[model samples]
Structure formats: C-alpha cells, structure tokens
Target: MHWKEYIKRMPLEVKQITGPLVLGEGPHWDDRVQALYFVSIHEKTIHKYNPASGEHTKTTLDGRPGFIVPVEGALDQFLVGLEREFVVLQWDGAEGSAVKFVRKIGEVDQDATKNRINDGKADPRGRIFGGTMGDEKSPGDFAQEQGSLYRVDGNITRVADKIGISNGLAWDLSAKAMYYIDSLEQNVRRYDYDVDTGDISNMRHIFNFPKNGLDGFPDGGTIDTDGNLWIAVFNNGVVIQVSPEGKLLRQIPIPAKQVTSCTFGGPNLDILFVTTSHYMNKPGEGDPQDGCTFMVTGLGVKGHPNVNFKF
Candidate 1:
C-alpha cells in the first residue's frame, strides 16, 4: 500500500493532557505504576500524571532534568540526568512530597560547564544510553560537536563523541540494533548494538530530514512493536513514523510546534504520549497548546514496556 493511503486509513485522535510548560521533554510511561512521567527542562520540574484518576502532580527539582527513568526494583527511586551529573532521585509521587537527591552516580563534561545531558533511554538489558549537548541558549545556536554519548551501567563509558545535539534513542526488540538522533544533524543513525557489553558500533545514517523533505530537526523518538520509529520534529508540529528501512511511513501532525519528545504509554501501550516545548516563544506568539503534553491514540500499534535502569 502507498504510505499516504496507509496513513489515511489509520484513525488518529489527539488530546492535550498537560500544558503551558517551559520546554517539556522526556515522556516515559511506568507500566508498573500505571502512570506517565516527564520533565520540563527549563522549568526544572518533574511531572507525573495518573490517567485513571485524572491527577497531575509536579515536583520541583534543584537543577534542570534532561530525562528521568525508573530504577529497577525500586518504584520510588529514579535515575535523573540533573544538569551535568547523573543523580539518584527519591520521590514518592505524593502531593507536595519532598524530593531527595540520594547520590550522584556519574558525572560528565566536568571541564565543560556549558554542556548538559539531553535525552536518554535504557537498553533491554537495563543499561542507560544518554547523551549531552553543548550550551544552547537559543534555537539553532549552540556549540557544535561539544557533546558526547555515554553508556551507563557499572561505569560511564563514552561510546560516541563529537555530537551536536544528542537526542532520541531506542533499541530494537531483539536488542541487536539501536536508533539514535542528533538533532543538529537532522538525521537518524542506526548502530550495531551488543546487549551484553553495552557497546555500539558500525554507525550509519538511516534517515535524513532534508533529503526526505521533512521540515524540522528530529527530536525524541520511540519504537513500536513493529520496529517502526515515531519521531517528534522540533519546530515542525508533527510526529513522523519511519520504517526500519528509513522510509517515511506517516506524518502525524500535532497542534503545536516545538514538539520535543514522545513515548508509548497507556494500559495497552498503544497510546503515544508526546511532549512539546515553549522555549523562546512569546506568550501570544505561538499556539496555545505549545509546551503541552499530548496523547495520540488509535494508531493501531503498541510499544514495548518501558526499560528501567538496572541500578
């Protein structure tokens, strides 16, 4: 079937859940707790939403949170990318619960004060693959190639360096291939992954934005059960679905621009939860739904369970 025809048959329903954030990023669904978790980077806050009860709560953090992932065997504990350091966060998800910084597991870019962690995800085996980006005070203006990608398990290992804007990560169901995005490059790269050792090699570009006629930089992404990638495009107001072979399968238009990240959530894991940013936009300039977290449903697909850090 033609890509457009296939997409036309798929019914889509999008709804805004949480909103008006300052740079909302990183949406992770905790199946164990049946809740959705995400962070607003510039706001330095972590948010949790319970769909069953329609309850939304946020906890302010001391530093910018690039991403958050649940820790294995501990529901209240999470590993967060806090500025330049990877810290263990303890929060009970209670209303106005006090948050605690348990300890710092690892730190990156010690000499580069301007760099901070960006997007991250855990491999099927529970090892974290996180990356950082250089000082980016404004859109399209950042220190190029000052960031690096690191694999965190027992130790921190720099798997790749010279990154422009580290964003989006996903491992295939078989754990044999990894998909990554560096927004500045406007492309998605595939890597041969080793699940046992947390190593990646043989990197190759799988998707190019301009070549495919896509408008904005590719931001955060997640993989469906079919191994297709759903990527949020910054400044494009769309989430695109790309086949494993790098074919443009579908373009899911969002109501707001500055779409940052997305993840599969909900009881059946068929819902795609997306996050957007309000960075640099004046109050009356952009869409009212800007910086809101949205839920895209009825795609007729499901995603794997959220991976947790082994630590």
Candidate 2:
C-alpha cells in the first residue's frame, strides 16, 4: 500500500477517555472479551475498555501496577508486576486474592519501590521478559543503570545487568529474536533470544532516537504480524513504524505528549489503539488532546494474539 494512502485512511474518530491519567502504558487487547486492558501506573489502576458498549471499568491496585499479562498455559490466570514484587493476581482485584511475596528479583533490585517494572510480554515459549526504571523524579525518568531487564519462569529468574529503562518488548516468529527498548538511552536493542531457557545474547543496539527535532523518549511497543516494530516515542507524542532491520517505515503523529504504548486490534487489524499519559509537561494550548485514546484506521499491522493463561 502506498504511504500516502495510509495517511488518507486515518480513522474518523479517535476515542477520548475521561481522565487526568498519570504514567499510562502497556496496552493489551483481548479479542475474546472485546476489551482493552491497560495500565495507569501512577494511578495504580487497571482499566478495561469495551468498544461495543462504550463501557469502561477500572480496578485499583495496592501497588503501582506496571505490566499486566495473562497466563500462557492457564486460561483463567494472570500475572502482574507490582513495584516491590511480582504477583499472581486474580483479575477481580480482590483483597485476599493477590498471591505475592518479596522474593529475590530474578535479575535486579529486591525492593520493588526502588524500581518500577515497565513494558513486558510473554514469549512464544511462555516466559515473561521486561525491565524496570529506578525511582527517579523526571515525569517519566528513563535514566539509571540500576534498571535491568528480566526473564521470569517458574521459580527461577534471569537478569540482564547492562540495561536502563527497560521498556517495550516483543519478538519475531521466524527468527525468534527479541526486540527491546532502553527508553532512557533513546535506543532499541535486539537480542538472540533463547525462549526455552529465557536467556538473551548478542545484545547490541539497533536504533536510537530523540534526534535533532524529536522531543519524546521511547516508550512501549508491539510487533506486527509482518514482524515490523511499532514503537511509541515518549515525549514526542508520536509512533514510529519500523522494519525489523531497524529502518523507519513511517510515522503516525498523535496529540498526546506521552504515547506510552501501541497495540493493533479490531476484526481486521486495521485499527491501532494507543495509550497516552496525562503525567508530564505543561499543558500545551491543546494539551487535552495529548492524553486521550487514539484509534486510526488502515494501520495494516495485525498484532499477535495476547498470550493466554495456561491452566
């Protein structure tokens, strides 16, 4: 498809949410439930958005929730990364249903409060991999070498020590490589990912942004069915579509200052759902546009199905 045609096909209406959202990220679309699962880390909230009925429901958490994903083997289970610990949590947010403890962090800090888990996803092999951001004051602080990427499976954990601001992660099917972002460094790194062992190697930088005119940092992202990487740029309020080889294919400009994450959804995968934030910067003349949810037509990027809980 021609790139010009793609822009012409932008969706008619971008959905707006009622929010003064703080630190929004990690959007997952559940096709079976016809809902979008997203996190507002600062609010310590998980929200469910149903398009068909225009119904939105939010559930609060005790700990600042970072990334949330379903179990790969169990249909009814889910995992949540809270500030201080990882937990097997019931989707309902019940008081006694959160199974957690301050186990040694498989790869990094022991105190969750010292670091915040950012973007994460399950590999085809069913392991969850993500990293954390250290406690910092920048609206979305991406600095701190203490932030390390992690892999969690069963009782064992693996940590990659050279990481900083571990955010945005996904994989390619044929090559089985892992694509990850170091949001703080303004770079995206690729790895020779070992799915079965949850190990990564040949780690090297592939791309970095915030070039001459860009304002945002890199945030969360997704891999399209075609293996392209769609990354949200933090301060810039834009999403960039890139080829697996680290080439920029195109860009989608958004009104929000923080384009925290992006996911492809809807029946045909032509819809792109972006989660934004209301946490940073002085409101521009059009600041309200920055935090609203955006949907654009003709993305042509179909996302992989969310990993389900294995029972």
Best-matching candidate per lDDT: 1
Query: lDDT of candidate 1 vs native?
Result: 0.90
Predicted candidate 1 versus true structure: per-residue lDDT over 1-311, tens digit per residue: 95445644778899999867989998899999999988999889988999889898988988999999989899999999999998889999976689987879889998789999998988899888899999987766899999999998889999999999999999895749999999999999999988878788999999999999988899999999889999999999999999989999999999989999999989988889999998968657997899999999878778899898887
Report the number of the highest-TM-score candidate: 1
> C-alpha displacement of 163 in model 2, angstroms?
2.8
Error of 1 at 124 (Å): 0.4
TM-score list, all predictions: 0.95, 0.85
List model 2 lDDT by residue over 207-259, tens digit each. 76744345667788888888889899877878898887778887888778778
Q: How far is candidate 1 from the true structure (C-alpha RMSD, Å)?
A: 3.0
Give the local distance difference test score of model 2: 0.71
* Total backbone clashes of candidate 2, pairs 3 or more residues apart or in separate chains: 17
Q: For candidate 1, list the clashing residue pairs, or say none.
A: none
